[model samples]
Target chain A: AQSVTQPDIHITVSEGASLELRCNYSYGATPYLFWYVQSPGQGLQLLLKYFSGDTLVQGIKGFEAEFKRSQSSFNLRKPSVHWSDAAEYFCAVGPSGGTYKYIFGTGTRLKVLA
Target chain B: DAMVIQNPRYQVTQFGKPVTLSCSQTLNHNVMYWYQQKSSQAPKLLFHYYDKDFNNEADTPDNFQSRRPNTSFCFLDIRSPGLGDAAMYLCATSRDQGGYTFGSGTRLTVV
Candidate 1:
């Protein structure tokens, strides 16, 4: 079965610091990976996705992720964190060609401090 | 201005009472999905409608039901909602293109 894993449950980073959230996926074939962010009391918003082509994908809100096929990883990164970036991040994976159902990771909560 | 819209942003219901949550989309996408998200947990897919076809997840409770009356409207019905059912219910829509557009979500609270 296809699944996603987010190792960190919670992470705290000071404002202006860099951020990295790790994600790993298990699938038998090429995967369609995605990163989504959810603010408190709000629905999830898509940050980025990697379907095919370039490994590095850029997304909204200055977020970027790199898809490593060898490691089955799609790690979300932000060079400089802001107070507004504090939210829960989820990594999802779907089959390259099949059902559109997405398997999501447990999610990582990012706490930004000044 | 196309987006997914969920009604009753915050819903409060008595335990064991049935309640309905609604979702509508202006994107006119072929697929609409419902997800249940508990506190600090990943969102779980309850079901989805590809056009008029309803697809339910295997582990979804029988108390939870969905209806897609039209391409633009979808409803989630909870029969005898329990305290455990208090969580955020999200609605999303997508086309053949990758990535889904999610609504603001309905926060369901069973008292």
Candidate 2:
């Protein structure tokens, strides 16, 4: 079974500070990884995805993630945090092939302090 | 713009009452998914429709049902909603399986 894990349940960072949220996936092969953000009472918005080729992927809202094959990790990073950046982040992974069902990780909630 | 749309942004229903949530997409995607998200928890996949075939997760209870009449519409029906059913229900669309485009979810509140 494919699974994604987000170790952090909650993270607090001051405004203008750098941020990184860890995501690890367990799968037989190299799976497609994604980062999504959701505000309270709102639907999820895609931040970035890693299919193949590049190890580093850039996404909307100045977010970026690196896919490290050795570590089995794809951690989301932001150069600088903003007050409005507070939200829940989820990491999802799909099989490299076969059925397209996706597995979602328990999300990490970020609280930004100004 | 092309997107997945879920109706009734917020719904308040009495316990044991049946309620239906609707989802429609302009994305023309082959896959439509229903996810139940409790507060401060990950979204749990209830089921999905791939074109015309219905795929239900093994852990999904019999009380939860889904319908996809056409390529662009899907509905989730709760036969008897309990207080535990109060949560946000998300509808998503995908071309294949790489990723999904989600709609602003419907918050179901069973009182």
Candidate 3:
């Protein structure tokens, strides 16, 4: 079964500082990777996805992620964080070949400090 | 914009009472899914409707039922509300391999 692991449960970052959130996935074949953000009392918003490409993917809200096949990691990063960026982030893995089912990680709660 | 919409941002029900949460979509996606998310936990898949076919997860309680009358609407029915069943119910839709479009979700409270 495919699964996603986000080792960090909580992360605090100062505003305007660089940020990185680690994610690791387990899948048999090439996995469909995705990053989603959920604000308090809001639905998830897709941040970015890695289907097949140059390994580096950019997303909305000035975020980016790199898919490392060898490490089975797709970590999200931002050069400069903002206070509004504080939210819960989830990493998900799905099977290719048209399977829409996704296995999501527990999620990482980000706290942006001023 | 094409989106998924869930009604009643919050709902409160007494123990053993029946409650229904509704979801509708304008995206015309072929798949609709229901997920239960407890506090500080990831969303768990409860069931889904692929066009007209219904698929339920093995661990889903029998007390939970769902109805998808047409491509545009889906309803989740909880036969008997329990404290453990109190959680945020999320509805999502997708077309084939496309990314999912999720609704704001309905937060259920069982008293």
Candidate 4:
């Protein structure tokens, strides 16, 4: 079974500080990794995805993620956090092939302090 | 911009009453999916339509059903409402092996 895990349930970061959200996935083969952000009462918005090629992938809102094959991790990062960056972040994994179903992590809620 | 659209941003329904949530996509994707997201939790897959074929998750309840009448529209129908069923229902669309485009979602409230 494919699964994604986000260890942090909540995180607090001051505005303009760097941010990192940890994510780990379990799958038999190379997985397609994705990061998504959701605001309160809103649908999820895709931040970035890792299909192949370079390990580091850039996404919207100045977010980026690096896929580490050895540790089975895909951590999301932002160089400078803003107030609007406060949201729930989810890591998801889909099979390299076959079904399109994506397995998502429980999510990590980030709070930004100005 | 082409995107997935879900109607009824919020819905209130009485217990045991039926409710339907609608989704439409302008991307003309081959797959349309429905997910149920509880408060502060990951979205759980309910079902999806690969074109006109419907696929249901193993753990999905029979009371929850879906219909994709065309390539651009899909509907999620709950036969009876329960307090536990209150959730943010999301609709998404995608081409084969492509990333998904999610709609704003419908927040279902059971009273």
Each candidate's TM vs. the true structure? 0.97, 0.98, 0.97, 0.98
Number of the top candidate by DockQ? 2
Output the lDDT of residue A19, model 4: 98
**Candidate 4 residue-wise lDDT, B1-111, digit = tens:** 998899999999999999999999999899999999999999999998888888899999999999988899999999998999999999998897777889999999999
Clashes by residue pair, model 2: none
| Residue-wise C-alpha lDDT for candidate 3, range B34-106, written one tens digit per residue | 9999998999999888899998888999999999999999999999999999999999998866777899999
Candidate 3 segments exceeding 4 Å error? A96-98
lDDT of 4 at B15: 97
CAPRI verdict on model 4? high
Per-residue lDDT of model 2, residues B6-93, tens digit only = 9999999999999999999998999999999999999999998888999888999999999999999999999999998999999999
For candidate 3, write residues A65-112 as lDDT tens digits: 999999999999999999999999999888532456788899999999
Which one wins by lDDT: 2 or 3? Answer: 2
Considering summed lDDT, which 10 consecutive residues are worst modelled in model 3 chain B? B93-102
Report the TM-score for the A-chain of model 2: 0.96
Evaluated on CA atoms against the true complex, candidate 3 attains a DockQ of 0.76
| Candidate 4 residue-wise lDDT, A1-114, digit = tens | 678899999999999999999999999988988898999999999999999999999999999999999999999999999999999999989952378888889999999999
Each model's lDDT? 0.93, 0.94, 0.92, 0.93
How many clashing pairs in candidate 1? 0
How many residue pairs clash in model 3? Answer: 0
The parts of candidate 4 lying over 4 Å away from their true place are: none
Interface RMSD of each: 1.3, 0.8, 0.9, 0.8
Q: Write the per-residue lDDT of candidate 1 for residues B7-53, one digit (tens) a residue.
A: 99999999999999999999989999999999999999999888888
